[model samples]
Target: MNITLPGKAATLMASQRERAEKQRARLGVEARSWYRISNAASDDEAEVMIYDEVGGWFGCTADDMIAELRQITAPRMRVRINSPGGSVFEGIAIANALRAHPASVTVQVDAVAASIASVIAMAGDRIEMAPNSMLMIHDASGLCMGNAADMEEMAELLDLISDNIADAYAARAGGTREQWRERMRAETWYLPEDAVENGLADEAVQAPKAGNAPPAPEEDDEPDMARAWDLAAYGYQGPRRDEPKTEEQQPLTINIGAAVGEDFVEQLRALVRQEVKDRTVAPASDATPTGPVAETEPVEPAPEPAAVPEPEVPAAEPVDAWAADIAGLLTTPADDWAADLTHLIGPDTSSRAAAEA
Candidate 1:
């Protein structure tokens, strides 16, 4: 299923995944949460102590237990458990392997059988609990991030998981699936007596050697009153954890440019038209007179239009000089009329006349 989570919710899911990975690592052999397999002195029964959480070791699994059983080939086997439960998947697998083994299996709860650990306890051919031990069962839980639809799907998935757990419990405990589900919902804690009374165990037994028992958590303080839905879902609530507060959503703001529309375009066109009209309008000083100017008492006469002068004709060149020059040219004739004309005209005409000559 696709899920679009907000940034904060995504970060929260990532942090939770990292924490689970770290826990899985810490529950390994290096952290001393191993399954110690040994044989009884007479070698009649194989003894296995599950001192750690389910699926706690990285290098070992249900296959390892089955492998151990294969090595012994004993007619009987003893499984001891003291765990707060870790991986439900691994626990269920181990339970099935034990139930299917050739040997008659005897399951002894040392300290606690909570979550999937309780489910594993039910695989015993004859279940026994220590006097001071406890057992708890509850619905399966998981982490998810998504929208409302995704959340609804997750809820349905959890219900399905819870049904599977109830089925496992009902197989050995002799109860209706619904009844077991109700007990799981309540996070029912069962003391050894309570477990026997509820048909969850066959009988009570003496506590194992002090050295073999599961150690109490260090704090040993009173339970915290805080609500722990996640841990409670898994049937393991030690000290309550405070729920982290979510950050508030800030208001979203955006700036968009002026909206475009036909009306806006019309308004823009009108504005451009107005600007063109303003520039095209003649100035008041150059405008034609529309009416007489307002006057009080004296009125100044309007100035006349400036007169345009007529073009002047050049006076006729003096007839006496022309006549004298003509008479001189006629009297000074040399070989031809062209020489007389050149002498009458001047040096420039004389040069042209000589070139022509």
Candidate 2:
């Protein structure tokens, strides 16, 4: 077990350090990787493991990783997390396994323990972060899918996960669930010293030859670990989406044609019979739908009056006294008709001659 860092070890270390330096340059940050403290069992009987890089957002993989952890039969266990954090559920699972261990468990962060990784780090009996090392605790982020029922189940699952986190974080750190929720919502990040102060971390480890300078706790983004699982598990295939769909886009509909069948005439007959039976069994109205006033035929309009014709006027008769005066002037009044006639004809002429002489 006391093999010096030689033989093939120097070559391996150089290659790993080369890769780490390249990755750090490519990522525009210092290269960080998980390192298990060799001979850590004798020193503290507690070994620590590193969770680094993007995988930290997902926590460490459990794909055969569980078996890897089981190989460690150390009296005490230490999980040294140097990560940006990873999957929430996986970290929780790892933490759960650690929590059940009979040995004292400690989480040592040499660099950054963030997001779900921070949650995982909390599983230790004592949470320790180097002064230069930082610890961040934030909410989980992931995609989801399924039918309405499936979605509902997922929602319930998220609620349960959050509840467990609340209880665990609160027990380890001194704060209310409400405060945790606020901080998680804000995507809060904390320095090693502040993490300890906030009850999330128990102690701050001294910075070795490495940078263990504690940072000011700040805020960060939540990872979408759940969503990643949902995506992979359900085989999501569709257009891209920024947020997960709440319910299935389409619902199942009944086949009316199948239910109706080909016996349309029989169906109609049955309906008619049912209607008749209903009418007979139910009360029938005796009165007409139209009221008596409305039913009476409208009285014939009164005939218009005929226009009347005006009366004709007759001419007036000649006066009798004016006729008799003319007769007396014409002849002797006692004379007969002939004398009257002569008087009427001659007397006027003789009076005219005597006047002329």
Compare the candidates by TM-score and give the number of the best one. Answer: 1
Model 1 residue runs over 4 Å out of place are 1-31, 57-59, 206-357
How close is every model to the real structure, measured as TM-score?
Answer: 0.49, 0.43
| Clash number for each model | 0, 26
- Which lDDT tens digits does candidate 1 get at residues 123-203? 999999988999999888866676888777777877877888898878877878899999999899999988999889999
Q: Considering summed lDDT, which 10 consecutive residues are worst modelled in model 2?
A: 1-10
What is the alpha-carbon lDDT for the whole of candidate 1?
0.70
* C-alpha lDDT (0 to 100) for residue 281 of candidate 1: 83
Total backbone collisions, model 1:
0
Provide the global lDDT of candidate 2 against the true structure.
0.59
TM-score between model 2 and native: 0.43
